[model samples]
Target: MKKLILIIGLASAALTFNSCERDITSLNEDPKHPTVVPSGVLFASAEHALLDQVLSASVNRNITRFFTQQWAETVYVDESNYNMTARPIPRNHYNRMMASASAVINSPGVLSALRDARKFLEDEGVGAVKKNNNIAMIELVNVYAWANLVDTYGDIPYFGALKATAENPGNAEIPYDDAKTIYLDLIKRIDAAVAMINISEPGYSNDLIYKGDMDKWKKMGNSLKFRLAVTLADVEPALAKTYAEAAFNAGLFTDKSDNFGLQTFPSGLLSNPVYQDVIQSGRNDFLPSDVLVNFMNSKSDPRRDVWFTKVAGLYVGGSYGDENTFSDFSHFTNAISGENAQGFLLDYSEIMFLKTEAAARGFSVGGTATDLYSDAIKASMTEYGINDTTATAYIAANPFDAVNWKKSIGEQAWVAMFNKGFQAWNFTRRLDFPVFTNPAGSLVEGVPVRMFYSDQEYLLNATYVKAAAQKIGGDKVTTKIFWDKF
Candidate 1:
């Protein structure tokens, strides 16, 4: 009897083990689920969420600020040994901007999100839902992407974005399109987006950027269009005049209230990445270039105090080459304090400068070049909490030169763009006004016209990069884009 009972128990245990194994095998055979949809993550309401990540990862904060000052032609090189003559960083703002543009253009998920938004507008007739908000989001992404592409590579994959693939890939070897063509397409897209806004629909919810405000989005779309129109003043005067007139007539950003930007706080993961790094390491990698510090100092610009902090009684900044050095810098502490800083997308001052340039170029805008230029200066100072008295004095001291309109326009725009590297980089390449000298040890000589095709592209998209290089004349760092002909 005992032997029989033992045999039954052994058989039962075998059966149980087999059953468990079969179940486990069945589970393993099923396909694994994707972690989450890409659109859900990439299409967040906060426009700056992706931007912040890309900026922090690609360009160190100190480095970006230095590039801004340098490219805008606002600063001068004072350190000779450091070669303050070389390109600041090989993959500084220009490279990062190009990479980000490619990601946005190539990502299937982002393309789908944009298409869905557009379809929603068409089906819902702009008023059936919060159509305008969706349009705004689409326009924001497109505008940002277009601006980045133009600023970096000059001609880029614009109309064929998301359509280029291994099969049926038109322009897989994208030849550099004229800057004029790219700008025109951007304008058309912006107009279509603005037209979709219907005030009656439910506004955007979960909007991380504007927090469901359709009116603000409308203003932003118009303001951005105006900014783009103004950018073409030097290259395409007739089209620039037409677009500027249209944008102004359509109601462009009128004040700081109309500025489109995101305010980053210190509490969450969303805090300014630059501030986070500074606080975490207590080392500020950036030093203010003598070029920038002296420029502001020469004009007695009160913005110096607002933009930088004093250290050891000297208005010192983190020098470009002082990253690993232990030397005490003047201006701001090389230490990255966790100070709250806002990441501006498009500011009133930038818009003002654009208008100033357009007006100076004889566009039929409501303001004169001097009017727009002075307003830009005042707006910049006011934004930084600089006293009005100081702004007035600076303006008076550095009067606008009508004969040298480009010089005046470029200088003021550079100053206004203080920490905004994207704008500074674009202005520098497009206008070449502020006349920046290369930093010491730059691999490429003279102003780098185009960013070296990224290593990732070389490794993954070798064929595509090769084709693009061929079209643009060469894959070298010194290859000039079409618009660099200033």
Candidate 2:
């Protein structure tokens, strides 16, 4: 009889077995393992994997916090200095998004699992309304993953990725897709997904973000559309303006309550990834970076009171990429470092800031740039629990700088996006604000504009990867993503 081993929560699992029939083909069937997994389980697992990879502070998988200089390494500073090869960071992220092979628990990946869920949902012949809403939710998540991949790597195997078959195995070489083309298509997908969301019906019941709340899902879809439009402002201004306005017309996150967030479990494999990295790891390799803290300190940002702990009665950060004593630097607050802390995917604060940028660029996104900017800051302050008086005062002091709106919006967006490393990195790259200097002993001369394609891709799909590298002007860390035209 074939043996089945189930792995659970980053640990080993052993299954009890009974004697099987004598037939060889019968031995292959494991009763404990079902041919089809419930769509909800696959969807939920996919969501967890997506959030864990994106929201994690793990040096091995993700280090965007260091890349954006929001956090600095205390000892092993390779990642902080733009070293892409020390670990398979890009590979881990890539796998989290597109890996097709299923684990013992039916967890494929973000795209793979969601695609599988769609297939299973179709196979089961669910009701039209429920199925449409479920499929829409899946598409929304797919769009988010695809956008993230395009933003990280200049080009990727889009149409060819996550589609393994009997004739075409998972390891088959796939051609790279143009990033701009992919972004345009993703915007279309978002629009379709939003259109399909029947608020009166239900969504994925196992959803970690909204718990079958199709209304919130619909809002998030439009919110995502607006964010993507803003990303294209420098590259596709007219298209960007049209979509931004369309997204506003559709609707968006009305307030903080509509933010897309994942609450951390109390314990086990489902615990907060941040808490796992900072507290459970039994290491002190990371601390807030001076690049961030000094900026926050300079503006007398009220959110700082709740973000970091005081050292010597003042919020102090470690010099970016420098080795420092763990006890000497300010640590992240309990609100962030606690085991049950929540990690956000999309925030109303971010949408408001996008609106601010859109208004600044002459897009009719519903308000003046100055008013929207203040609203963005106020939303961020409220999200962090700062009083209205303090928030208003801060906004008054740092009034919008129309001449340098990018700097004004980008810098504050960076602050507002604390702990959301990926979006913050996007802000820094697109807006080119709060300029970061190359860390001492760095791999590149300056901050990396895009993450290099996974090294494993070179070994596994050499020809296609080489073609992609050449198309993107070499697979170096300095290569800029398509939308980062500024």
Candidate 3:
């Protein structure tokens, strides 16, 4: 009887151990739950929340750097307002951002987080947790995505954000939203965010963008609204005027201090990704453009010195191409090993230029065109250490003639946006200013209007691509966005 009892005890112990092993194995097997919290947050943020704001900030800044290089001038991708060395493969910010956004957008878990925001708001009540904070974040995310999509593809999925679920299903294969529809939706989302915000409560915490500052978020929202309205000026002038007036009444970014931007860290893995890549890898691949260099030189603009370094009395920069080819001209061929390199989303100078353009167009946004234009110019010069005398002199010599003002606006904005590709690309598309003559040997056949749908989109979302093509009139390089009106 004693032997039988001991056998039974041992059997029970073995069963318990097996059960524990099963639980441990299951934890490792689960693919849906990400291992890291910050990674999860970043994934969610990239797709449904505010990833592009950060990603584009980095990527656009780099593009500006590239434009300052030789290729933009020789090929005419951007008119060289600044003389540069050679062009590099337009750094892949769009690819990286798109990949991150796509991973979250296509994932079921991330989608649930986005959908849960609505429920959390409902349960907590709009005012209880300052519901507008959540709404504002969501609105900002959607707007960023929309801007990126349209800027890259002209038209894309706008209304079907988190709404496209199993029930009340939207066409995953939905057609592209017209530019007009997209702009209208952007305004509506901004309005909703503004209305939902209750500045009385303690603000949000995990908000990586504004960090619980409802007032600043409101300012950003208003500024974004103004930006969208201005983008539509060529396509729908009447509506644009109304929205611009509303933005002005709401109060736009008042100063550089009020500018919406991301502050990158000096070190740690999360330090500005661009700075990390460029510094560590010795991969400074972009060169300044000749068109820009000539323009700056003509005005005796002092910013040139701050932006580019002189090698043997010639402003030199790296080139974009295969590793073998790039090695020929680029000086820094190893990882970047310095500090102080960082990224910015939007700056005071950019906001100033927006206002300058609005004033130039007589859009009823208070401020004289010349004053705003001069302010924008000076702000840019200050960034590059061009003294006040030079800045003032450049402004005086450049003046604000309608024809010349348009050219100056494009050139100045382009210079300010140096290293930021999407902004330059967006500005080029909307205004077609700076009238850059294309380089003789661009790999891209012509100035590409939008990026080709990612390989993943081509394979997995082919149906959606086909439908989008039908709506946008062929998903090719030439298909213009609604605002393009080409």
Report the number of the highest-TM-score candidate: 2
Question: How does model 2 score by TM-score?
Answer: 0.93
Q: Write the per-residue lDDT of candidate 1 for residues 35-68, one digit (tens) a residue.
A: 2222212234124333553345123212334444
Query: Mind giving the per-residue lDDT tens digits that candidate 3 earns over 17-104?
Result: 2222222233235554322222213323433222233332233323333332323312333323321113221213223333222332
- TM-score on alpha carbons, each prediction: 0.77, 0.93, 0.75
Q: For each candidate, how many residue pairs have backbone atoms clashing (under 3 Å)? A: 25, 0, 44
Range of the 10 consecutive residues with the lowest summed lDDT in candidate 1: 71-80
Per-candidate Cα lDDT values, in order, are 0.57, 0.81, 0.53
Candidate 3: residue 187 lDDT (0-100): 85
Ranking by lDDT: 2, 1, 3
Best by lDDT: 2
What's the lDDT for residue 178 in model 1? Answer: 51
lDDT of 2 by residue, 2-30 (tens): 11111222111111111111111232376
Supply candidate 3's per-residue lDDT for 311.
Answer: 55
lDDT of 1 at 192: 83
Which prediction has more favorable TM-score, 1 or 2? 2
